[model samples]
Target chain A: MKLRVKYSGQLRTATRCGEEDVGWSPDRTLAELIAHLAERHAAGRPHLLSDSGAIRPSLLIAINDAAVMANEANATRLRDGDVVWLLPPIAGG
Target chain B: MEDTGQRSELDAAERNRYEWQLWVPDFGEAGQRRLKEATVLVSRIGGVGGTAALQLAAAGIGKLILAHGGELRLNDLNRQLLMTTDWIGKPRVESARRRLRELNPHVEIETIEANIDEGNAADLIGRADLVVSAAPLFAERLAMNRAAVQLGKPLVDCAMYDLEGRLTTVLPGRTPCLACLYPEPPPHWKREFPVFSAVSSTVGSLAAMEAIKVLAGFGEPLASRLLVFDLRNPCFETLPLRRRPDCPVCGPISRPAP
Candidate 1:
């Protein structure tokens, strides 16, 4: 399965690319996809996961423009061609 | 029918001053009248808040309560439009008040030298019919959100980083509040983030428009939707927002009839 992932705000800066298509195992959870991307993009690893390898609570994950709560992100299963967006909370005035 | 007495009457001078906007189809004299009677609280008069306050005053909002604690620094000029070089050491909110008053003398301007906190958030938000949350910290933004939810007032939140900007409106019980989106402060968020003047003002201008729409009771507001934009890529996307049934801040409040 291939999933399209888009980055916004600081995540875009860290990833050095606005979006990319990542090939992943079918029926894999979103958490696995995030870990794969975090490993591939070394600069975005810190922003994507904490020291304990858990996804950061502040990272907003959305599938097709619908918000997924931080806690539920790990359990969210992905399908082929799903579009995921990762955005970090930005508060600069 | 709206309570004309509470909305107040627009005098000839006021009508003439806002003649162009008054020509809007649904927002004719009625909308202008509502603007003349509404009081808005804007937290932090830096890049986003100051710009939002300026547009609100220009739109003839009856009163503005600005709260920003800090003296102007040389670094603030890049996006803090309300500050002048001469007033570097002076309080920032005063400069915001002065500039806003200069834009529209008819609109009342009030300044508070301190930013919103848990202790004072309720008091500041209670006095205004609507709120604009533009503080740079999640702590302050969440405080204002809690107060707005508790007081049953509308809030427009403006934020930006680098070339990206975001805006959302909270209609208390009817829509998702700030806490619904961010249940807790982001651990990695720092006080200093990259801010381009253009991006900040863009979000601020949209925030002011959202406030005006909510106040005037015309046009569609950004309730339950988050508008995110990236100027570098020149892309704008609206993400659907859902209220968390367990959201501590707004979950218990009963939704009012539309």
Candidate 2:
């Protein structure tokens, strides 16, 4: 499946993935996709995952336009032309 | 219709001050009167809240309750527009009040020099018809969310980092509160992050507009939707937000009584 991943905030600078689509195998879960992105973009690994190799709790994953909660993210599957937004919490006022 | 006449009449000065915006369709003198009668609370009047409060005052909101702690510092000048260089050592809320009052003397201005916390969240939020949660911490944001949910008031949540910003409107039982989006603060979250006045003000202005729409009953509001802007790529996306049925803050309140 082809997924278009949009990196938000500091993640964009860290990942260097701008306006490009990433390819992944069928039935790839949101967590696996994030892990794959972390692997591909080594600089963003720390931001995307924790030392325990889990998708960081702070990372917000939106499939299409609906936000997937942290607990449900691993079970959520991606399909062709899925648009995923990797939003980090931006607390600065 | 019973109280329409009593509620919709705007004074001569108000009519003149909001002349340009009064031209907006569905938001004529009646909308202006709604704005004149509304009270909005903007917590932590810094980059985001300060701009939100300024726009609210410009729109002639009846009362603005501005809350923020600490004296201004040189570092805050880049984004805290309400704080001028001369007022560096002064309290931020006082400075914000002075500037907002200068802009719209007819609008009532109230200031509190303390940031939102458990001690004062209920009292502060209870006093306003609407709330703009521009505080820089999740704890403060969650406090505001809880208070808003409990009080059944609308809240506009705004935040920014570097060139990105996100906004969502919470209508208590109707839309998702901040806690529903992030059950707990992100592990990587920090108290301070990269911020630009341009980005903060952009979100702040949008938040203020959301508040105006909610108060004046004109344009469509961002309720149950999250709008994210990435200024680096100049991209804007509005995503649908769902209320978490299990959300501790809003879930129980939305449940039907047995």
Top DockQ: which candidate number?
1
Q: Estimate each model's TM-score.
A: 0.96, 0.92
> Between which residue pairs do clashes occur in model 2?
none
List the lowest-lDDT window of 10 residues for candidate 2 chain B.
B1-10
Tens digits of per-residue lDDT, candidate 2, A10-81, equal: 677687765469997776788888889889889878778888897775577788887887667788888999
lDDT tens digits, residue span B1-258, model 1:
244684478778898999999999899988888888899999998889989999999999999999999899999999999889999999998888788878899999888999999999999999999999999999999999999999999999999998999999999999988988888787777888988899899999999999999999999999899999999979899998888888999999997777
Candidate 1 stretches greater than 4 Å from native: B1-7, B256-258
After TM-score superposition, the amount by which residue B53's alpha carbon in candidate 2 deviates from its true location, in angstroms, is 0.6
lDDT of 1: 0.89
Write model 2 residue lDDT over B54-153, tens digit each, in one string: 9999999989999999999999999998888999898999999999989999889999989999889999899999999999888999999999999999
Q: State interface RMSD in Å for all models.
A: 1.3, 1.9
